[model samples]
Target: MLVVSTGDLMMFGISAVALIVLAYVIQKTRLGRALRAVSFDRDTAQLMGIDSTRIIQLAFVISGILAGIAGVFLGIKYTLYPTLGSLVVKGFIASVIGGLGSLTGAVIGALLLGILETLLLAALGSGYSTIAVFAVMLVFLLIRPQGIAGSNVQEKA
Candidate 1:
């Protein structure tokens, strides 16, 4: 925990993003192309002699690495308590408000959440921060369930 300073947070953010990008590139490689073929149509991939299990393993590994790094940052930014990361409902709200399962939506949602929370806390009080964020999330949900960017994510995408 002591090692997770602000500098570490900055480093982690940069490195993790770089790694994820690299992983994406690797996924686009020959092996990655094979994996994509498998994901798009498993029966076709298998008929074409592609190993579906390995592709699934690689996909899970890539996602796991990214999620682990994000969890680490969460731990560093907050406390060591078991419930520390769990209390971050705004992040969840942001993810949902941005459009479910859409990466761009999640990012935009996070930015909106952070800005809104900051402004509300300044105008009202810290106690109303979560409330404000949640209120915005609800409004967005009612107004546009697809999010500000629209429902861009398809089940197969």
Candidate 2:
């Protein structure tokens, strides 16, 4: 049987709120616009007076902060281990499944991955979860390499 505590619910709430705020910040603020502009075309953004270097630095800092928060939550949920960094592979898979640069895609992909892993574990066994997840990822890559929300564009060489 699965058991959930108030703490878990609270943490989930906090995570959801943080994600919403992040989405808003990325979608509605001038800084967000600048960030998006820098991502889309750094040279053009620089020509328009956006400091690409500063924007890039800010993005890194923000990513670090978010990662720290995630680390804290992960530590609270699971005992910290020296090899916990290896779990980044799951995150990479989620990103690939969702689409590399789409925040919404990442979230959806993560949720989908979690659901699929749980179902696979229940149906097969814990040992099969990783294999199943990777198999699904491989299938997705073969069928839709751009991911659920990514666009496929040919780049000029």
| Top of the candidates by lDDT | 2
Q: Where is model 2 more than 4 Å wrong at Cα?
A: 153-157
The C-alpha TM-scores of every prediction are 0.67, 0.93
Q: Which ten residues in a row have the lowest lDDT in candidate 1?
A: 148-157
Query: How would you encode candidate 2's per-residue C-alpha lDDT over 1-157 as one tens digit per residue?
Result: 7899987898899889889988998999988999999888888999999999999999999899888888888898888889888689999999889988899999999999889988999898988888989999999899999899987744533
Task: Give lDDT tens digits, candidate 1, residues 9-126.
Answer: 6966776676667557656688767866876788789899888998889879877876776677766666688767545676688887888745567778878877887789889898
Clashing pairs in 1: none
Candidate 2 residue pairs in clash (backbone atoms < 3 Å): none
Local lDDT at 108 for model 2:
90
RMSD in Å for all candidates: 5.0, 1.7
